[model samples]
Target: MDSNNTNVKSNADTILIVDDHPSNLQVLFALLESYGFRVLAVQNGENALKIANSILPDLILLDILMPGIDGFEVCRLLKAKSETQHIPVIFLTALSETVNKVKGFEMGGIDYVTKPIEHRELLARIQTHLTLKKMSFSLACQNEKLQQEVYARTRVERQQALVGKITEKIRDSLDETQILQTVTEELVKVLNTDSCQIELYDEKLTMATVVYEYIKEDSKEAPREHLRYHGKVRQVIEPIYQQLLKKIPLQFVSTSLDSKYTKLACPIFENGGSKGILGNLWLLKPSEAVFEELEVQLVQQVASQCAIAIRQARLYEASQQQVKELEKLNRLKDDFLKTISHELRSPMSSMQLAMQTLEKLLQSDYPHYKSPKFARVLEIFTSSARRHNRLIENLLMLCYLDVKSEVFTSELINLQIFIPEIIQSFSARIQQQQQHLLIDLPEHLPLLSSHAASLEHIVVELLTNACKYTGPGETIGLQARVTDQAIELSVTNSGVVIPEKEQHRIFDQFYRIPDNDPWQHGGTGLGLTLVKKMVEVIGASLELESYKGQTKFTIKLPNHHCTLS
Candidate 1:
């Protein structure tokens, strides 16, 4: 072997040479070393196996003829063991027989060299096998990297899917306790924790209470006692609660009286943590198992959903309370109205009866003493009694309508007859007010099928309003006509124009037009409101228009097949 061929610097490829002849080992070692290859020469198969097991060289060259164990046995042993199985082996021998070469290959020899010696040929073979081995190792490493990346991606997708499931379950409920309970159960399963719990803080942030908890079935630790601790006062774990209130998540190893465990606490907040803290979510696992980053993020996401559910449930409760309060107030109002009707109407009836009796006595028994002054006093008393009676009736009617206590019975009403009767009831008042009354009942008007009493009250109220607002000699007209869809009845009063701005509110209960009552009518201000309510009860619509010293109120009753016939 020539030592002058040392152009190649130190290289990393190592080769193990196993030969029984010392001379062959020396020559091969010097040749491989001159080419910058790390060489290890072992004389026997035992040492060869030992060195190969220790260093796992890039390639091995074994001689066929040996003392204790032949090259064939060594190659078979190398291939049998998993550690050195991939190393390429080449047989070096002086035997030129074709049978020996074939046997060498069957024993796991990759190539064979039959010679006195051929150094360049051997080096060429070594370089080729080393290149193949390096390429194989590089490919194996790349394959492992790709496998790891794929596994990581799949894990992330699975975690995201679980988060979506937990979110859906929590959001489906509006009950605060139910929402919290669901969150704890789902978190324990998803995070593989020994236990899970949710603790809510008081409004003042001075105390915390455990609202929900879940423990794994086979967990060795006993269930944690329900917590109701004052912050920084009662419990040693108060600092954890304080940290969570500050919107920070914490992971720590907690040593309890029984055993040690790991815990993670995340704050529950609304509006991306901008609002006040609602509560905290807690997860616990055995001390040997640690919480991962992805698990922490999952807890935080679920906590946000829980906050939303809690807020919605609280709002719903508040609205229910308001509705109850309003119902209570309505009941009280109805009771007061009933009491007034009973207490006041009885005396009003007696006064009217007494006045009637006095008039008859004066006309018949005291005919000689009848005088103008006495007549004026009698007239004044009658007028005030009548007005007082009307006010009581209006108030009672409003109460009935409000409570839906009045049941209206529908009947066929001939407008020709009905309108005239309503007008007749108000005829005396119209005359007393000095208002000119007009009637426009077309002979061909259709009969109305509706609640008769409601219709009667509606028409009477409208006519009374017209008579009150119309001045002396001003026209107060009651008219009825047939339209394509329904029968239209309208009440019009001249010399009074209700302001456009106040017309919309005229039908509101107790709402009076400002500066519009010049007659000091002293009305209860419920007449028009009563009309509007009665109109709706009878399936009619009312429209008001006032302009140019004239005001009109039209009531359209739906045509329910009650034609003129």
Candidate 2:
């Protein structure tokens, strides 16, 4: 459009002429040229239209009564277009009548002069209209400027009122959804638009979602998801977000937004901070109005409010998570208290009963013939007393770990020296049940620095449970080895298989397995629980598994140095 501006060294207007007569065009072109006016000459109306569009000459000397599109038609066509209408036209002809002048007027002839070729009079009329054209153009420009000033003031007032009302509505809303709905409702009311929505950015800067939507009235069809401003505008707006992430807001206004609506994205910022894009405000028709300077500022304010509300909503959600954790801790405290009570009372009752039974035996006088059987029963009774005392001891150790302090008696002991002797102590039971004891302790193993008594008890408990649970012909195996961070002692027994599901909860206090032959085996259910507690007490670790007609217990002795102050 600016192609014909012609180096444009200084401010000077240009004139264009169209005529078929060579003599008349040459003469007129020279005369306008002599007057210091830049002239453009074309032989016919076709060249004139091309040159007119190219140069946009300030004036046109259009000749009527010519071939093709005549002066009357050229004048009419030029007048139809607002871009060309302002270029003054003067028709040169020899017709002299009232009707002819009216016809020239009808065709948008600004002035007409009769031609017998009086050079002086012709120049005078040409000069008169050109001067008048300049004056009229100046006056029209001043009037246009006045209208623009009034429009700008009116637009500012309207934007202020709309922005103010919307701000009030948005400020009243405390939550994300409510704030979004408030902004959308106000925008629909004031902007008089359709399918408007607000989208928020999540903490990770990913697209969260549109919080509110306002569609055009009288539409029953659903809004197309792809056509919505939030979904479609993402790629074009990546640079916009890049600036926003650094906390700087920007305004982008364009009429070509996807082959569809003209759109604006006014970034939202607040008190030295910025969030994401706030204004996806759009108009479907191609328009220059979508990107007014006042509109940019108005939408920027709306953006600022949205950033604040969305950030506040995020903080609210975080607080809700904190409250949930506090509730969980409260429940944990209740469970801990209940567990402690059960751990204390159950062991005390067993020890009191064992003591009463042993005292009765000591006072009774037995015959010499029955002395051995009585002595065997007393041994059984005494072992039960030791088991009860071990229960109380395990509970006390567990209490220390719960409060972050565990004290264990440490000693340098060899697994090679210790494991075989422990198995030998259980030899009588192994032989009585006619069971095979497969021991896997190796000689020249690492010397373990830990409480030897607790390690022995953990291994013994696993072996004892295996012996008691399995049938007579089944084999009980004990294996101990040093693995990466700890010593792993595993005892596997065949004949009786514990259900897989109950394996996990077996360490919980008082948990028991449903024995298939209830008459054959019995337990206080404290052995494994106490085993787990003892391992924790000595800073060791434990795991259990029961599968495929075999039950295995594994205890890992940690190489830990527990020091005292």
Candidate 3:
């Protein structure tokens, strides 16, 4: 044994030696042991075969010309069996004849040493064979690892493609039943399971219904169509369902009375599992072929897609219901408005005519009774009638706007003339409130091609709003200016500031600024809302700015419909 050779050391490499002579065995064993090789010695070929089968050492050294079952026979037997074939064998022989050496080599002996064995030559031969064996094992391990990696990559690719296909099939429809059915069918086909089912829990999660299921024709389990699991079944599966609710996927081998099957349960949830789970996806195979980790992950991905489809279908259903409800409410509202339009207007018109006739009779036939108090009473009666009429008109106008039934006919108009006329109508009310009115219309203002009635209604509502909120001696300003994009018409009032937060909501129907109406100029709150709608109808935009003791409502009429006059 060469001690200086780095490879010859006590590294736990085992070598078995077989020789009939005890002296030869002892000498060989000592020499190999000193070089740190684990040595096992036997005297005959039969024992050699038995020990080789038991320990399967890294290397074998055999002596030829033994008593029975010679070295050639031992090597032949070792080579015949599959388990001990790969162990390297070096034959020790005294006969140096070419014929015997060829016989040994044919029997699977790797190398033969002549009987006057050189100790160093034997050790060197053993080291070479050990190194070769280790190299062979390392190569085999590398090849196996490479094969496993390739298999895993292919499987992942296949899984991803299957997920895409399942997603497409499930999302093809917005109907809940169809979507769930498609999911069950596709999962059964893709997973090759005996059956696939989707069970949806009620909102309370106390009840579950098998809404959709697909079973192979030859499946062992009985078909369960539209089964409602409650009471006993529900209680039995409560633990499993609880795990699913926590978004933990489950795989288990479930045994029935006669057969055992594999089952997988994956939860379906909304909003990336943050929301409550909607249901569970169950897959079953007839045999005890446990679901692999990759298969579980694939099911989870499909479950996420199922969650989205379920949510979308539910949202679509909810929206359809809401639309039907809105349509019904709109019809009722239309009927009420039509009835009020007729019933209220008839009496109001009659009352107006009777009042006019009575006023004429009092003036001509009874001049003595025409006192200031009587005149004041007539004024109150007239104002009350006008307010009631205005309320009715507002309601009808809102109804028309809501249904988009208001017809708009566009015509050219000069704002320089049109705006002032609108202003003049509100002049009497402004004077009565003692509020200052400021007009800022340019001389060469552009002509607007828009719906005259819509524009008039918008201006009137804005001016009315300005009049109602402006305190006595405060200024109400109506200003018009041209910008590169449009004509800007603004109604600004001083000494009254709208809160920033409320400005955005003032245009909402029936909304009012709390405690901001000092004069109790009570209104239906539809004025600004109507204005906003009319502005949109005429293809203009409205904005509000209220700060620093001033509130301004600005309407921008686009320049595309404006011409220099």
What is candidate 2's lDDT per residue for 1-565, written digit by digit as tens? 1223344434556778787888888887777666666777776777778787767888787888788878888888888887888777888787887787899888888887777567778667667877888899899999999999999999988888887787776675557778766766676566655445665554455553454565556477765554455443243346666665554544444433354454544444464664444433332323443545665576666667666765677688788889999989856764675487477667666666766666565667434334667768767776766665555555554444445324455788867778888898899988887888898876646777787777787788888778777777788998877666677788998877777687787787767777643225466577787688778877778877777777788887764532211
Task: After superposing candidate 1 on the true structure, give the runs of residues whose Cα lies further than 4 Å from its correct spot.
Answer: 1-49, 58-150, 218-237, 271-273, 359-384, 402-407, 424-449, 466-504, 535-565
- Cα RMSD to the true fold for all candidates: 5.3, 18.1, 6.0
Candidate 2: residue 268 Cα off by (Å): 15
Residues 181-228, candidate 3, lDDT per residue (tens digit)? Answer: 788888888888877878888878887777777776646656543222
Query: Scored by Cα lDDT, where does model 1 land?
Result: 0.81
Return the clash pairs for model 2, or none. Answer: none
lDDT of 1 by residue, 77-126 (tens): 99999899899998888898989898888888889876566898999998
C-alpha TM-scores of all predictions: 0.77, 0.42, 0.76
User: Which candidate tops lDDT?
Assistant: 3
Judge candidate 2 at residue 414 and give its lDDT. 68
What TM value does model 1 have? 0.77
Highest TM-score against the true fold, candidate? 1
List the candidate 3 regions with Cα displacement exceeding 4 Å: 1-55, 62-82, 91-116, 135-179, 182-186, 203-206, 216-260, 265-279, 293-327, 363-369, 404-406, 428-435, 499-505, 511-522
Model 3 clash pairs are none
Task: Arrange candidates by TM-score, descending.
Answer: 1, 3, 2
List, in order, the clash count of every candidate structure: 0, 0, 0
